[model samples]
Target chain A: MFEALGLMVFYENMLALNNVSLACGDNQIVGVFGANSAGKSTLMYTLSGIMEDIAKKELMAGGERITLRGSINYKGRDISHDKPSKRAKAGIILCPERRRIFPESSVLENLKIGGYLAKPAQAAETLEYVFKIFPPLTKIVRRLGGFLSGGEQQMLAIGRALMAQPKLLLLDEPLLGLSPAIQYWLAKSIKEIAEERGVAIIVAEQYARPIMPIIDYGYILENGSAVVEGDKDELMNNPDVKSAYFGA
Target chain B: MDILIYGVINSATLALMALGFTLVYGVSRLPNFAHGALYVLAGYICWLLLNRLGLPYILAIALALGLVAVVGGAMYQLILVRIRGMSISEIIASYAIGLAILEGLRWGGLKGGTFTLPAFLEGSVDIAGVSVDFQRILVVVLGALLVGLLYFFVNHTRLGLALKGMAQDERAALTLGIDSDRMAVASMALGSLSAAIAALILLPLGSIVVEAGYHVLIMAVAVCIVGGLGSWTGAILASFVIGFAQILTTAYLGAHFQVVVAILAIILTLILRPSGLFGKQKELEERV
Candidate 1:
């Protein structure tokens, strides 16, 4: 279980995330849906502790000033001030937007690299599970990550994050630029992963059609704030949610 | 036959010198100007251990290497860590450190040609009617072995895989719990170890003088630039290209032209490819 309260992020005078609070329970899939620039990625980055790293780098380079104010509680522990690597070691893994797979490395090597924090036995077992869950990865294990198709890259990204043995996995726009068929298939896989591995997942996406069916609870983000929050059936039946997200 | 054999030997020597520099730059994108200072420091440490402390050759080499690795790690943690992400500052800070070490050694009377390490095997062997000294043969053998070992280490080991991931994408690696600062320190230590190994093996061929430090740095930079900065395979291949050019220059255009060839190679690579051979040209294009 993880909870983020009153999360606020600012780039200079512009607020990227404003007073947003979200939580995920054990073995649950929480969907955060919004259009472009709705602070979905920003929320994911802040929760994953990557914003701290970005802020540090920017300060060092005398570039933009990024301010983050939030408390990320993971299983009764306050990890707001923890470094990104520490957060990851504490089992909060973020599969970033655009896949961000290691371009030059082979798929197998990319997966191995992701297993940096896992015990040897855990890594080996998870590696097998990853290939089992995403069987397409087994066929192109030797291909360079950059050369893989978008769908394959997304699968590899998810597989790679799973290799890190996350307690709470953050999927940022996992359905972006993906075909509808692949999107539906990936959504199904995500559900299975949560049910089998019992890892809580928070997927942020703009395409809500495929993801909406799988999520137990969901939040609709507009601009930088959460506009609506409810369970699956409540969201599907809401008129505004239907027109905006489902396009029905 | 002489040219062929000598060319390969020179290439291996260049590869050995540039390996550390390339590795550090590749992983952390930090151009460690202190690399040359570390090379000379290793030799000086070995000399001190051998002569003053009365240690055996193997023991002295090991101790010297260990000491340099610690120094390299400290260098990264204390200084390089602060100025990271600022390339100009990183260069200036590292270069200043290098200057202090090299000049400090010179000040401490490391100038003369009196300091020389004995070869592991003090004999020459004939290969295809060409007699090569054991030291040169050892350089080639060890160079190939080091390359193979490095490939295996990077591919099979967890630390090395983390390093590769960091090199490709720092943020992505961080998400997997690979600490960038720790990896940078590890890279610096490994780079320093490679420099020390290079010095231990190559110093046996001639006297160990402070001037050799500057020469090694220049040659390493030239090799890295021509091979493509931060590319291990590029460094090796560029070493062969520049190595044979240096040897041929020495053979035909007098020995003084050896350094000229390296400088010219750097200039030409910069003017022509800019990114050097095998560099991430697409990345540059994307940035531009």
Candidate 2:
């Protein structure tokens, strides 16, 4: 289980995430939905500790002054000040937006690279499971990651993250720019991965229709704050959620 | 036959000189201007171990390489680690360190043509109709073997693969628990080892001098620029191109024109293809 309390992030004078708290129980799929600039990515980055890295880099480069005030607790241990690599070693992996696959590396190599923290036996087993869950990756195993289609790249990205053996996987816009069919299929696969692998997932997306069915609990983010937090049926019945997300 | 034999020999020498520079830049994007200093330091250490410490030739070489690797790693941990992510500062700091090392060696009496490493083997062999010294032949053999070994290491080993991943995407690698600073240190050590190996084999053909350090730096930079910075395959190919060019320039024009050919190659590559032959960063930027 993972819990974040009173998360606030600011870039100079602009607030990216304001007083947002999120929690993910074991073997549960939590969805955070919002339109553009709703702080979905900011929330994910802050959760995965990448925001700390960005803040460091920015400060070093004298670019921006980023302030982060939050406490991230993973099963009672506070990982608020942990570096991104340390967080990943603690089994918190982020499958970033745009499927940032190593474009030059082969599909298999990308997956292998993702297994940097796993033991040999664990890596091998997870690699096999990745290919099993995303069978299309098996067909183009030798293809360069950049050459793969968007759908295949997304699958590879998820598979690559799975290779990291994450306890809490963060999927940020996994279906962005994807066709409706592939989006539905990926959503289904995400559900199966949670149920089968028992790995907790927190997915942040703008398109809610496809992801809404699979999530047990969801948060609707507007601006930089959580506007609504409820189970699936409650959200579907809400008039504002209906028009904004489902167009009902 | 003479051109063919000499061209291959020249190509191998360039390859050996540029390998460490490329490796450092490839993994961590560190220019490592001290690469040449490390090369010269390795030779001096080998000389010291052999003469002053009364060690055997093989043992001296091995110890010298190990020392250089430690020094290289320490340099990263102590200094380069602070100024990382700033390219200009990294280059300035590294170049300053390189200057101190080279000049310090000169101040300590590393000059003169007296310091020469013994050839690994003593005999001339004929390739085609051209006769070449055993030392030059050793350079070619060792160069090819190093390249092959490096290829295998980067593609097959876990640390090497993690380094490759870091090279491609630092953030993505970080998300997989590959610490960038640790990889940078590892790469520096490996690069230093490579420079020492190159010195052990190549310094036998000529005396070790401080000037050779600066020369090696310029030659490595030239080869990297033409080959496309941080690209291994491109570096090897560009070495062959510039190697043959330098050899042919020396053959026809004058021996002094050899360095001119290298400088010309750098300028031409920059003007025509700023990204070098195999560099994809610029191309990707264009697409985006």
Candidate 1 regions off by >4 Å? Answer: B283-288
Candidate 1 DockQ, CA atoms: 0.69
Candidate 1 lDDT for residue B77: 99
Query: By DockQ thresholds, what CAPRI class is model 1?
Result: medium
Cα RMSD, each candidate: 1.5, 1.3
Tell me the tens digit of each residue's lDDT in model 1 across B1-288: 898999999999999999999999999999999999999999999999999999998899999999999999999999999988999999999989999999999999998899989899988989999999888999999999998988898889999999999998898998889999999999999999999999999998998888888898999999999998888889999999999999898888899999999999999999999889878756622110
Q: Each model's C-alpha lDDT?
A: 0.93, 0.93
Expressed as tens digits, the lDDT of each residue in A115-211 for candidate 1 is 9999999999999999999999999999998788989999999999999999999999999888999999999999999998989999999999999
